[model samples]
Target: MGGPPGPFSVPLRLSPKVLLIDPVRMLPSLLVPLVGVLVVGGFSPRSYLWAAFGLVGTVVFALIRWATFTYEIAGDRVEIKRSLISRSIRTIPLERVRGVDVSTPPMHRLLGLAVLKIDTGASGGDGEATLDGVTVGEAERLKPLLLRRARTEATPTARPEEERHAEGVPSERVIFAVPRRWLLYGPLSGAYLLTPFALAGGAVGLAFQWGDDLGFGRNAAWSVGEWLWQRPSLLVAAMVLLIVAMPIAGGVMYAVFNWDFRLKRRDGYLVAERGLINRRSVSLESRRVRGYEIVDGLAERWAGVVRAWAIVTGLGDSETRGQLLPVVPRADATAVTGDAIGPYQAELRPHPPIARNRRLFRAVFPWLVPAALAGLLLLLTGLTVWWVLLVVSLVMAALGVPLGLDRYRSLGHGYDGDRVAVRSGSLRRSTAVVERRAVVGWRLHQTWFQRRAGVLTLTVGAGAGKGGYSAIDVSEAQGRDFPAEVTPEWLAPFLNPPPGPHTPSDPPSTG
Candidate 1:
């Protein structure tokens, strides 16, 4: 056999430079020195020596193996070749490549290296095959090349704007970045990182104080309060420090991660790019998106911010999926939404007073159970002298009315040609939009209690993961008409059958 066919049928070469990162493989090497230090501090010297020898051997072997691995972009394909004992090769066509993501962990940042991930949309999925170490400059240079390749392989079509008005589909647009301030003030502000820090610090301080009280350490005389007092100025300084440092740090991180975020009009596609030290970009074709939703909380409303997200297929395996724009001004929500979903407007529908009557008796009313339980415990334990359960039940019932009213006010659905719109919320008001062709199914339901009250509920289902259902409770009369009035023109064929030729149109020419 002639040299077993050299890797590829054509001659190929890679750049001489190779970036090396031994993330988990470097763990044993790091542990050896710590073990040696402990051994010097009066432990087993022989054990330390053996461990060191093993670690060194492993590190040397890893380095050699890693050095033998190489990759190259040749013609319209990517070639990866690596071997220590048994050789292996992988070739990916250019068309299969989705995008490349480059990340720099803190350690990699210090070393001026980045993790270059080639997302090939392989059967293995996104972030599938990654080369974990490359210089920042090299990663950047490689990005355009990979994106260009993906673009070249992609089919040419109409501009995003033109595609928005395409028949049987609601138009959608992509937004890359909103103001950094909005992100910080909105969803990002609620990030749970601070809660853990607060809890951990409190626990540690409490443990230290308890240890001191037990005379465990003579030097540990400080309580958390005393410690704070000792550094009174420092505590104040720390508060001031966070106040100033947080926004700057957050803004910088947001800017970098979300840097070069561009929302563009591509035919039937929405593309989003965000990452700070590590960059990520996503492209969602129209068919992959299930629906659109608007999220508005009290904070969002007070800040004039509104967030929008979509139910997407194959995108949100991570926590960051489901959102196209994590936060934006409420005013901008409409415009940006219109851009993404062409020519659809929100309309409010009035609900009859009877429609809301059942809300007071259903799940919303059951919150009284918790309040009543707490109050009964207080009374029985002699914690209070009053008939607290009665008082608590009254208070809960009072709150339920407003809750019911808000739900009633917030519920509505409308259709513009083949597009469907439904709005609902009590605190975080929201509107969901979907095209008729996009609806997978629908259902009408009535609980036994609802039937007794002469009311029914309807839920509209779509294909996306999160915002798939739009539900509302209405009077029985309204329920009967709801499907016909809201069904989009494109979906009418599916919802109802054509009238048969023999079906009577009039009352038998009625007289």
Candidate 2:
């Protein structure tokens, strides 16, 4: 990726071990014939011969695939060519390279092999070009070189590991990693809700199948029903224990999925690596990072922590889900998030407020209407605990009065140099900070009510993370001038940044 030392080309192939380590890709063909032999114990000897033939053919196909797959580095581009049934060749220019991710599954680590992935900022494209079974050192060396070459910069001479820190190269200085205690977040992350149901589906199916095998089909059902009535208290206790166990099960699964999660800021890229069984590593260009989304769900907000994810283009859907800062304290989330995307300050400074009437109307119309209707129904029907229900409903509605006021208080958007930041939300709050240069366009929305109230929803669309973030319910006057203020070209009529020369950004830290 260092411009290839002139116009020469070098072709590379996967390490030999991939034919063994990656046999999972070949499993479907193998499994079909194996299953046939299991079903055909009554059939002739030809069944055995066919199974043998199938195993041999699967191996032959795998070896052929390994032999034909090759990637080459040339003067200006990287080329990958593969042949299985037909031939496919892809050429990616060095300048267009957006990310280089290196991942090592457990087997790959045992054999010291890794897969290096390259992503270009194009939609509907295959996520990356993968070179499987490469050595760890090669992946480490190539990730940064790919980004540097894409920037058309000269490759710096390699230095010792300890001395390289000051070179502004993306070296291994850990930014944020999952702490052992962070496992607390694991239980709250749908462990109780989804995990138990998933567990029940598989468990109930297996239980019925075993009951049928044991000739206890109807008897098993009757026994459980009989026990529920006979030992009601014991059954209730068991149910309580099961309910308590679900989140723990979910938390364990979550820990396994995100075990050993580590994040790093490289010279010109941000890298993340996580997973226990099926491990993955992702490296994204810092230059392509448009912004950061500091997200807090109700539980996360209660814990006073937030998660951060990169808002970048051409990275896979998974990375956009905030692998950058999976779960960190609010302070760390802010500092690391700003570093991930260049020149951001995740502050809570005030911007223009939405009209007070909007909040007032929202509080009354949405909350009071439903509460009043439900309360009236309870009264008219004379339902049990009708008075209690009425009280609870009114309390909930009254709570919204303050919530509406807080929602208005949280509404703000401002600029710091070329970056525009917006903070909005009441329950699950988010502060989205994006660079002005990254803004591709603006989307303005006004409902009949919003129009009458002099506020509008201004969505800033960028090439990165989920494509857009809204500056919800800003004053119409501010919404009209917002784009021009952030990036003049985004507005049709523009007073472009008072014609002045711009200085270059300093080299970012290797945090």
Candidate 3:
């Protein structure tokens, strides 16, 4: 039996048209080794024999299998016939198709081919499956057909006017383009400054190689040291120069690579296109967006650059889960988020105050342990022994004061009618919004330490495939009442009820 399908035979020729992808260009990837032998002059006479064998073998394989790779657009079902030996055939109902994406990599671009990926939402698995090595033009034509079929099948009983309006209306679209200056300043400049250190390191290695070639007999190390010593001042100056140059260079590179990055909105979708050497474009529907967040590092924060990203439910796998947008300017985050999420933007709540619990020690008293240990060691060494403990305690208290203040400053939360929002971070800030209906369960716990302090923690659980709410500390009084108030009555049954005395006391056990 033939091993598997190779694009060759035309199967079931009934179609808008059966467009045969050019196979000659694809044949190169299979023939490179044979060509390599002839070019390298290794057994030149035998090279022709190998090349001929390779070509004929590949062609025969392609022809036998091509008949198995066929796609028939019959009514609303897309029948994909693939495989050669086992001959597996599958059909995807048009109504279940969620979205389609088309990508053209550099190699595919050269051959005018494109890869079409179809995402059938969560039911289809983690993400989409791809059909690659199709002609670019054919893939483009297939997009509209798939989209039309999906839309019609999804809502087949629409009125004639509604159908006409749907056809006439343009789809919502958004483009993500980075500003040119930022890209030039960020990563490009960094590479330029780093080149010098690389050059110097290369020169040192080459000098050792030259010594070996001239039969210097292992004295190259001393020669290398002597060379450096002779230019000690110059060496020191060069080291200082590089230390100052790298960051500047890095900034330029970041600016150049990210320049002209723009996210545009059209119809009901968001489209992202980026890259300097190689361009890429991607599009996704707005309804598929589960949530989005803004991220900022210290430098990015001070520079007022905020990166925006989204949590798309079924579009990503383990490696790419929850990554929707790349980093963009902080100023653009709000506008872009609002546009993409539509009316749901109102449900985008800020984080609650309890989320700031971790920041109390992390940000406020980072040096407390180190400082106390140093004082204790000095005291044990008989230096300032009497006052060391008192001094350390006082210093720790001073640090704790500010820690508490900043913790309070960073804590906050809000809720829209249908969604809950929580915000918390120390050096970095993050805000999360979860739909109320998405919450499947919740719990309230009180640890001994928290109970003594009159505080308790709350945890919220959502649907599978989404992370649950972590233990967030809040006033014990507030915790007892939070679950009942935040969770709907429908979800209340799913929650573990608070422990209490049995209303119907059990009869005393008979001995």
Candidate 4:
């Protein structure tokens, strides 16, 4: 570390602890190479020397990297200088800074260090610049200062402090904090259900490999198989144990990731903090937030829980990038989102009845070909299996009826005040509400069948979130008119042009 020569001009290296953290991070990558060396050495203790050599190399590389890399906030940009043999410099403009993420991995947390990531909203190159390890205090200090300067550069006229004081508002407000009970909603969302299976699969593979190395693989496998074969009931018991373990594992994972999750409004930013072993803090510019999305996975919806994400312009596409609320009750999600971005109060206008037919047709269409094939097979072969296949296909196609109806029921769009909202999907239903000003363009899509059905899909193109939201299978007129209604100044002129100059059919020639 070095003292600033001017305001923030002194080049400073990462904390010394980074040397330790970097090696620990590289440990996983070293596993394959270390194992190969052991295999080549006939699994003898002599291979330990080769492993030690590789570990030393990793340390040396980390040390060189630490010695070479230096960063500083100079003038209007953050500069990163590296390379001893051939110098290289990378600069990120302060005005482009949209968010700052501070995270502490387990190793860093133990050492009281944090990692700082500066998000500049670039679509390429990991979308952020990372400082491997810094003192926790330094990270905390850097986050606000960097964001404040960036916010200042972006909007010179805005005075967040003055505005708050003028309105007699507190500087900080707690928006939402996850409750312990909400962790149960995790398994319902089905996000982490496969985690236990994945871990068990890897662990089983490793265990068998280790047994093989010990020359007991066949004995162990035969013993387990013989034991299970002797007690057939044990198989059913094992299945039941697995059935119970998956949800428990999913809940555990959800708790770990979302432990102590909190969302707060501080100054002019939305700050989120969460995680158990690897703590994370993300600070996003409030002004860049254009909308909010309330998502309902099928099971989560049935359980009356939902998650919310901030539709922030330039937010990264990472898993937790713009997450605002996680697996909370519908009421809680609604309240938090309402307070963050302006509330979405518009009552959605459902699509015309004809759209329902379209949805049902689309849902069942794919199954029809397979069902027909099965029917033909059964007729040609007169086989019982083909008959079963035919029956299964029909049943599957029948299942699509309810799915299509549910999808149609989910589709709707409405606009209220400065916000437009669209809802769609069945399995992972999402209701996105975006500010009118955030919408950059409008698109109307009509397939041949959609046109024949007198409906079209209206895509609302915005600069945030998934970039666009569609009101599927709406009336053609509604699809064309919705954009004009939402952003009249941008689309009305082209869509609803002033009466064209009158041209008489025969009178022009006569004149």
Best by TM-score: 4
**C-alpha lDDT values of all predictions:** 0.60, 0.70, 0.54, 0.83
Model 1, 7-88: lDDT tens digits are 2455332222332346354775466455545555465776667666766776677677666677766666667777878888
Over the stretch 57-151, how does candidate 3's per-residue lDDT look in tens digits?
A: 76666665665577755566556776778877666655555556666666666657666766665543433445566677777666655555323
RMSD (Cα, Å) of model 2: 8.6
Better of 1 and 4 by lDDT: 4
Off by over 4 Å in 4: 1-6, 42-48, 123-127, 150-162, 165-170, 203-240, 379-382, 495-511
TM-scores, all models, native as reference: 0.65, 0.75, 0.61, 0.87
Top lDDT: which candidate number?
4
lDDT of candidate 2? 0.70
- How many clashing pairs does model 4 include? 0
Cα displacement (Å) at residue 84, model 4: 5.4
Task: Itemize residue pairs with steric clashes in candidate 1.
Answer: 171-341, 172-340, 173-340, 256-276, 257-275, 257-276
lDDT of each residue in 271-349, candidate 4, tens digit only: 8999999998888888888999999988887889998889988877534778998899999899899987778877999
